[model samples]
Target: MRGRVDEKLPMDGEACVQAMMNETTMTKLRAGKKKFKRSYRLQKDRETIVYSPTRHSALPECTKRLPAEQAYDVSNILEVFLSTLTSRSSRVDREKAVGPSNCFSISYKDQTPTLDLICTNPETAQTWVRGIQHLIQSRTGETIVNKKERWISEFFHAADKNQNERLDLKEATGLLKRMNVPISSSHIKERFQEVDQNGNGDLDLEEFGQLYRQLTFRQEVEDLFNRVSSPGGTMTMQDLHRFLTQEQKVQADAETCKRIINTYEQIGDVKANDCLSLQGFTLYLESKDGDIYNHAHDQEYQDMTQPLSHYFIASSHNTYLLEDQLRGPSSKEGYIRALQKGSRFLELDCWDGEGGEPVIYHGHTLTSKVLFKEVIEAINDYAFKASPYPVFLSLENHCSVEQQRTMSAHMRRILGSQICTDSDTPDPSVLPSPHSLRGKIIIKNKKLPPDVLEDEVSDEDEAAEIEDPEVQARMQAEKEKRRKELEKKKKKIKLAKELSDLVNVSQAKHFHSFQHSQEKDMACNMSSITENKAMDLVKRQAADFINHTKRQLVKIYPAGGRVDSSNMDPHVFWAAGCQIVAMNYQTPCDQMDLNLGKFRQNGGCGYVLKPEVLRKDYLKIDTSGKIPDKYRKNLTVRVISSFQLPSPSEKSTSSADPYVKVQICGIPADCAEQRTEWKKNSGFHAVWNVAMTFPLALPELAMLRFEVKDHDSMTASDMLGQFALPVDSIQQGYRHVHLLDKRGGDISPASLFVYISLQAP
Candidate 1:
């Protein structure tokens, strides 16, 4: 008989059970009232209400337990959005610097009469652009990124003194001076303009705003209109009138309202405690049957629906990113305005230090420094509305691998449930998910993978092959078709999956979900957190993470990764499974190390024995032609040079064999591997060098072979010649095939070749 609707739902399981009981009680009360049951009967606590705790406990009733399911709210999600917004300038400048020709960089938005808003999230940016596109499309049937800028925002007071078309030299100078901009008057004269109306002498507020919008939207509208309308003008006076009319305002407002309504409808549909994301909102907005508010008001509308705080700015900056941006003060404001206007997937060029500390400034010469913390703080305040954190972060690492890892690690820690750095999702219930990276943040790099690069590799290897006009045209057509198909499929799939994910099967338990972040983190005694206190919390925490940073790291560079030795692990495991083979062979490491010798004590392991590509590192061994890379250099054969003395007169062409008597320098004085006194100082001539000194690229190779005849038949294979040097033998050993050179030079892997023919057998 107990019943009620649970309001302050918790994230944990207990809170969910409580909510269920309350709902059931509410249902019963309605039934009872219809039957005309006495008020006293309905008031019976024993039958209608469940106590707060068990075991005869009535104390501490105010203490509430929230499961992890209800912890994060809009504020948290907004916090993330804003945190990502502050780096807009860096994002743009970075992109522009490395972007292709005609590619633009970061820009700002003029919102209020004086303020320039910054956008950090890229998806929200694209979404905003699409929204403007939609608006323009719906009204005039035109679409463009160019026109939206002109009609969008506020004004520069002094610059548009006359208000005719744009800011003129004198007025622009006054405006720039007023803004405390540090620039030459001559420069201002060249770039600034006079915003005058009716050929007037001075520009006013409206004129300023006019210039702002012109800078923002007029051109975009014109370009878009040109594409959609005939010469007669698609946006006729009638269309203009309709767009300006209150109905269109309502239509626009309705879109926003519809978004909220549809979102709530979807939320209501979700019986489980799953959280909403921008991706979800976009889908819900698309599915509305006319105006969602109008449709929902009739039958299914519920007053207890979730708010807009359910989602944060979408982060697409980390995706489809360019490599650089070159920006200045004027460019920054336009970028901010774009974010405020709701563009998603802002583009960026990023650099990560070896320590993973990422800096956002981009330019031919970096005159400014952008700390990651500063970016986080600005984004938190500007975009997320002090709540939801950004949903994605695309990054490029122009720095060291170690730095990339560090920057990546911090991103996971900061974004929390919104995004994650590791390639997997973290479970939510775990207080701080192990490596509790945020859920939605995504990062990317510019370097192509082997597979992609392979795809790009031209089989013909000549510009002429790709440049044939017919071939080029055909290829272009194919690319366009492929692109369109990819876009169509991606959208269709995303839309379908988004709608599917929105349906909440259970009204609780979302692993690392947004709705859950709230129920888990929301405190009953939160009123004490005043604005200043909240600001302080933001500044302190943001400062802690984004301030000046420097990091150093050491790691192993996979082949072709970079040209540095920053990655090295001195630790080596001499376990049983270790095997060895000759480098510079058609098939290296096939056979095995046949014995123990003084060479083992000299530290010979397959992993450490790199080709001579490394000798240039410290020894300054700049071999004539072969280039040195981190990975190849890490394994070059070095110590062998000490023992094998090459005859300078001998021509060491890879095709021609140059035999040199080389000592295996590491042999111990007592012949460590020699078993008895008879084998006191046994030694063998090393017939090869495993260095891949030859410059040939792939699958191509060369080899060096040795002919070893047993000096003493008794000592035979007991000698170390199978792997390294041999100890005391009557005739010692023959050094017939000394060193072989190929494209690179030397038989790297720097091991050996065996030849044995027993006397009687």
Candidate 2:
């Protein structure tokens, strides 16, 4: 069991002499020649200072060792000692010894000495200090000094908690997990190899517990023993021998260790290879901001690379976005909201909607019906006008390729022939380029190879081409026969690259990520979200104006696709304020000085917004003597919402409800009534055109809604439906409908019922 213990182990050899001389001798040692001249005068010097302490206080029994002189120069003293004593305290978690836990997070962390140590060279330092001490007291200068003997021995004796000798992997891992100190169990085995005294591969509890607290290397072990062994810091041969064998299976599996490491690392931004905290992973995903979706086709190996943008949100869900999106009917609305929040690029998918007009909505069923023009008009009429940035519309064919073509043709007609086809129709757009439209429209679809033309010449001859060597050589030299035609068969798909220059090329795909969970339960409302719904869209846009704009002026356009397929006019509302606009290009997290800890603890994602329309009716600029003829007109204001105007003090008093007045110039008194004609389209409360006095340039006035938003709308609530999903039924029969919140709330929820029947239908 033990190495051949030579009876004559101590040899007066060079190895013994070399071990004593170390940097400690040079650094901590001092020597000088006094003028003693053969040590004659030092005799008197020693007699004068003859006062001595008791034997117990003497150097040998001082019981408090000073740091040892360094072991003399060598490449590495520890490595040599380790070779002499191969005792390695390695008790790797053997999962075969254990079993798997029930749950796991996706990511993990690594918290080991290797990862944590920023020191230059640690192992070498521990060796020199311990090696010399062992030689003096323990009779052997081996640096290895483990005293553990039982794997089940208590590692933490100071604690009065549940006692277990040589803790198992689960217990150890759990301890580290709670401390947020992530590291694999395997690391402990590797570390033990450096400190094991005997060649044994394990350690007992005593050795392990001692090593955990008192095994730091500061002086030569034997020297410390000889100098002050009574006061501690010295290890006997038995202690050294015991420490090496005190190993236990703390984490019984590599996976378990890895998981613990991952959890800790994620919490502290530590790298556990792949383990990510559930919340951390969400934050990471949100940080991507759909960049994968925004990546261009020009990217290298586009097909193979999974973008950060297209993260698998759920097992049955994958969202392909060219920008801000999740591939659902809500994508368009999401994009618009992104813009409101300040995004540069917005993305949405376009499909044939009601009235055969291309409209934007994501689901297979129906949704808000709004014409393209309504969105554009709302943009124009808003308190804030839209920015020049383009909206990217990816038009797809839920219908057949032929139907797609028909829609394309119709698109060109309504868009003033700005949409054009390429290849077959060479010349693209004439007005500006469709591609130059603040954004782009891409027509995406799968294409089969075009069919090939029939062969013009036939080879009916059945003669074999082979011939004898001599005859073939002579015949081939003069064989200039008519070239045979090759049959080139290929599938063809007619693509419409029209108006591509004006808008953007609409790309296509035959792929769809998610499908209806219960197909049989879904009824057809295919036409509900179509361009025909633009009529309702117009109403929606007009309502937004009532909410945020002062324009009482009204106009009606057909409810259908006007441009990029979104319900611009009807579905969106505006907020009035000193809109926050950020410059300097800081990311969402950076600008906000977000608490990364809090962000991860709670679900967090990055966000940005692009200001489309910015209206400045609040601040008035006076251009004194600036272009005289261009100025000088009395201003007029219109009534938007329908409610009694609050008294100046009452309207201006409430914090929950905000009220303000804006002035409009260039309006006829006759048209003034047209602006205030009370109707369903008016907002909650508004005032019509009022004659003004004073330099009335900056007139003092007020406006407000008298009544609060009715909570009875579903039963009847206004603010209730603000963020709720739209109704699936747009038909003419009043039917009760219910919507549920899967998140489960103790407060008032979406259980309120509403009846919706298309008045027109």
User: Which candidate gets the maximum lDDT versus the true structure?
Assistant: 1
Q: What's the lDDT of the predicted structure labeled candidate 1?
A: 0.24
Tens digit of per-residue lDDT, candidate 1, span 465-550: 11233333545646565445434422111111111121111111111222343445221100111122223333343221111000
**Residue 459 alpha-carbon offset, candidate 2, angstroms:** 40
The TM-score measured for candidate 2 stands at: 0.18
- Give candidate 2's error at residue 758 in angstroms: 59
Q: Give per-residue CA lDDT, model 2, range 189-267, as digits (tens).
A: 4545544456465433544443332222212223323432123333222322222122110213445434333433335
Model 2, residue 34: displacement in angstroms? 99
Worst 10 residues of 1 by lDDT: 548-557
